[model samples]
Target: MTEPAGRPPAFRIADLIVAEGPEGAERILIAGLTVTVSAGEIVAVLADDTGSAAALIQVLAGRRRAQYGAIDAGGAGRSRRIRPSLPAGVSVVAAHERCPDGPAHVVVVDATGTRPAESGAKPAHAAARRGGAVLLVTTDAEVAASADRTVHLNRAPRPERRPKAAVRFTTQALREAAAGSLTAAGVDAERAALVARVLVDADVRGHFSHGVGLLPMYLDRLRQGGIDPTAEPEWSQEEGSVVRLDARGGFGQVAADLAAERCAERAARTGLAAVAVRGNNHVGMLAAYREHFVRHGVVGLVLNVSGPSVAAPGAGRPTLGNDAVCMVVPRAGGSPLVVDFATGTVASGKIRHAAHRGERVPANWLVDREGRPTTDPEELDRGGAVPVFGGYKGLGVAVITEVLAGILAGGTVSPLVHKQRAEPERAMDCSQLFLALSPDAFGNPPVEELLDVLSGAVAAGYPQGPPEVHLPEQQERLAETMAAEHGVPVPASVVEQLGWGAVRTAPATAGGTA
Candidate 1:
């Protein structure tokens, strides 16, 4: 490949040697592999297996050192050791992962057999369009044919066998098991049942990260006195349309439920109401609170602030919580329109879930301690931080959430809040805000009709002849229906941690008990 007049080639690898196995008896996986990728070029390296593709990409990513080679990524000098402090310009995307945002000198993709070549090539082309060099490692001939250049590598070892399928449990049985576990951990039976319902609801809706997978963490906090199971949320201060509730470092689910109920009731009488909750622990999912307002025939908005996990723009360390935002609008006879999400690219729980499942994440989801993009799920816990979604726009959402949930609620802010998992013995002191608006207050303008017209207009604007467009929460609602008819699939690893051994022996039924 030719280099630009004044700039170096995007990346140049010469005499690269990758080996595995014992030191002296090492097996030569890749020998004398040389390739050059120029800026605005798409180069494909066809290999036999994903294992080989990943090994070479790892060397390029500076995760592993090549046995013998000289790699100059960008205009940087050639070096065998690519230190962590090296300039940030190279990004690695595994199969099925989305193309990362931001400028990159080189984008390496390991697309061996995990996804179709066409799908993998789309991102490579996108990177090239952005004036970045693309190094695609694939096992498919179609992918090689689509690239600007193709390099072939010899066969490498295959990956290990995949893990067993997750165990399935009936919704009722799973809820019972969760409640029982919570009760055993010293939470009162009534509170345990309430918390279990919230968790199982999340699981059935396909939000596994906030589902019963968190029961173990909750149990630990309860046992360690970080969460007071016996404490009840009470109105600490009250006004006409506004109130403050003290969670007293209790279960966040319980506190949020109470706040939602109170807020809805007050809104019904006053047209609008807001409830601020202080001294709260970790709330599983904001969706659970939406149901209360929906049932009360009102619009609901919920905001929550947790411990810091997201970093500010250009900052290497975390400065704010990922923070959650939820909005629910009651539709006359249909399911409520629910929109729920974290302000970060992804929630912190997602990283934890991926780490627990021994999986890598998309590169854009997190940054290492030095602010370089990473795909490692474990990095979030090691001084790594998640970036705000959509850059500065999402940061604005997080800032507003913190102001309302933390400052306005008179509760601990992100920096002062305790880590839920790492410091389970201390109070998290998180905060939540529940706002309810009575639709009837404004004569209940034809909301259902307006929503229908809006949906139709959106579909009409689509180029593909009125494509099926699902409303927010529609996919989750469908998942909930499917789970009710079939069963909730819980990872075997999570089931083991919950100590529900008998579930494996239960008789199989239509709901997939066993």
Candidate 2:
């Protein structure tokens, strides 16, 4: 095809390396880079940081000179302009969602930043419309598929930076602080203590994503009256082995605990029992509630719908909740076999914390609204979604839980709780299902014997890896024991956030199994 009148050929660069080679070079910024973008074609560049991205953009726009190699910027004349920002006629959408007016010579879509600040701006399409080239500057896993080509720079890896020192709190002091804050936030004395215990336990279990990181929002919910601190769950309905509980929008941990206790009692009599919980709040981890039944030598299963922050595989949008499932069975000679997991491809909390720490996520775990793989955790808030775990199988599990826990319990489901998030004063309006089964009911053989053989088989094939082959609760119990001896550490920032001052370095004897 003939070039348009007065339009220069597509911009091209080759054998490029940006460094301080002209003088006292401290370090190399980019190395062995090559890029080519035809007029009316878009190309994406994935880099580690915005500063390096900006530096490359300046070189391409003829604002700065590269230490090595060549750049043919189409017909754009060269200049030594030190523009702190990108050159004119080049659009750059950074953390702020603002977009430039018309298409320019080049466009850079900054996909790294806080999630809430990113709006889905189709940079490639926008550039294509103006018969221009787009250079997507991002660390995100993918640029738009419309890219004519991608240029990956081969820079020497930087030294790993040490994380800043953190404030630490003993297990006892942290729990007390959490309880006090929840109490101040209007939770009943007993309920506040229970919630604190659940949250603190999550930290000890090394599940920081589900730990006290949730306290601020919980407190806000209390302030908004979305939560009834003194709310008492009632047994709304009961059959021989089936029970329904009304949490009245109270803390979900309290509701789950109640359900566990009741389900255990009913299973003891009937040999099998189930409980449905409605109008609950954040229940922390289902493993906690499942332990209640495992302690009683009853097999246990618990299921709950989480925040609708995940997307179904091929849903083209964020549609699925972070549903969770947990099952535990008692063993006579060993810790109970426990399995627990969320249906989201990855825990959303990990994404949240990664975004907080300015870290990238695994690409396979997330997809942008355009169904492009994304490592930017920020995309989760920008109309992107975490893919369902196990693909359609994970979605199937989520649907089943919604029916068994949501619909069966006569609580919220469907569009009601589909996109809803739990607030302090606002009810999650979700439901939870708990099932307990006693082996005595079925004249079952000794499960411990079977488990012993099964465990032995697994341990026997350890291949000299990871020291010891531990079953589910085995490692957790060991971690708990160590944490018990050497108190769990709570972030000092978390302590301050909870209004706990005057840090104490004493060893703490907080809640832990004997």
Candidate 3:
């Protein structure tokens, strides 16, 4: 790679996080870095530590601003840190890693449930077992052989004399490149760009799902003639409470966001508003849609439907959908109580994450090819099912999501089947429903006042120190503050995975700007 002229001298900057050695010891390091792939190209960085894998995702997604040089991020700008609440389980992995092994699960279970004593069953059994498509993570090889395209990311030593600034692509540039790549593979440009944007933004939000992890899937769909590029949302207002959208089976997030925003507007006027979107693709992160309602001070609820990708209760077959539900309520001084989660015990992405590192998942979390309990991640990976969270309860939520989000919006998924059609980007015909309610619509109460009441009660009920009870998104704010003042703690595994080592001292610079 040619170093750009007139750029400032490059210094090694910490980019990735690494978890190394046995027992997963963690560390953070900043190593010299360079992008070897060409623009519009896809590369997979094979490394240890899923966090670093996720961080590399941030670099690719255009979320992290290039600290050293300019990089293209499609047409979108760097994600604005709104200082909103992080999702409920956002920091669970980090906490789990740090928690004492003896009583960690019990304490977490006690705090997370509806009631302190409501530990109905182990969380492994508490998750809903529904059927639907799940996003998975795998090694570069698996992605390359099974997936459509794989971009290889390998560590490269930086030159002793670094360029002043590294050239980067903008979101628009990435969109154009992705669209062209899809088009070259016979996919439509406009639709491809929409999909690219959603996937990229996921990376920006630090979510592996719906991010670069999906590039291979997108390419596969393109190769299979699955997506129609010129597709757009077909909009129509059914009634005062209903807004119907047909995404023409294009991009899921774009359609879902549009529908959610419309619902928020309608809800603001009326007490309740509902928007149903059909023929859309795999909309990544239902939480993103919830964020819209939270920002508008509207209580938001969302349901997304998928087919037999999830496991059902008592039944061995994947009967229920990986139906996901999201709820976001307004809050004061922190992010809204953002609740985003899948009904299943674990997301397929996490399973893929473990698989990528050649790790074994917890025994209870898996089932055999015949759908019995097992610790083999591969069984689940290769065509297996995960039991519902708590037999009937989890299945119940799964049913609810399917009905409200799928059937209500006129989408169907019975037996899970991967189809090749020039329609949406995922699942046969997925649908999403957004419902929003403004606090004022109910009784004309001040949002802040109401927030104060709810938050105060919750806080007073559980004082600090004894497993301090925090409202949703509260802990994330604390985590963010710690990160801002001290810096986001990068595990050692993550550092090596990104091929960037952490630096604690400033190096003497060449004839570069101060």
TM-score top scorer: 1
lDDT of 3 by residue, 380-425 (tens): 6566766666668888877777778877765564344233222324
Q: Estimate the TM-score of every prediction.
A: 0.73, 0.66, 0.55
List, residue by residue over 1-514, the lDDT tens digit for candidate 2: 2224453445555545555421211235555466655556556666665456656666654566664455445533332212333334343433221224421123543222112233223645564556655555544444433455555554434543333333445667667777888877767788888888888787666566677777877887777876677888998888756889998887888889999888877886789999988877768877877567866778988888755777776664766677778888877756678777777776777676555445555555667787655556688878787778777887898898778777786466633552323344467777788999999998977888888798788787777753442566665676566666666655544555666666454344444322
Q: Which stretches of candidate 2 lie above 4 Å from their native place?
A: 1-163, 356-358, 418-425, 459-471, 489-493, 505-514
Model 1 RMSD in angstroms: 11.3
User: lDDT at 289 for candidate 2?
Assistant: 71
> Sorted by TM-score, highest first, which candidate order results?
1, 2, 3
| lDDT values for all models | 0.75, 0.65, 0.49
Candidate 3 residue 474 Cα shift, in angstroms, is 5.0
Name the candidate that leads on lDDT: 1
Give candidates' CA RMSD values in order. Answer: 11.3, 14.2, 21.4
Question: Candidate 1's error at 222, in angstroms?
Answer: 1.2
**What local lDDT does model 3 show for residue 378?**
67
lDDT of 1: 0.75
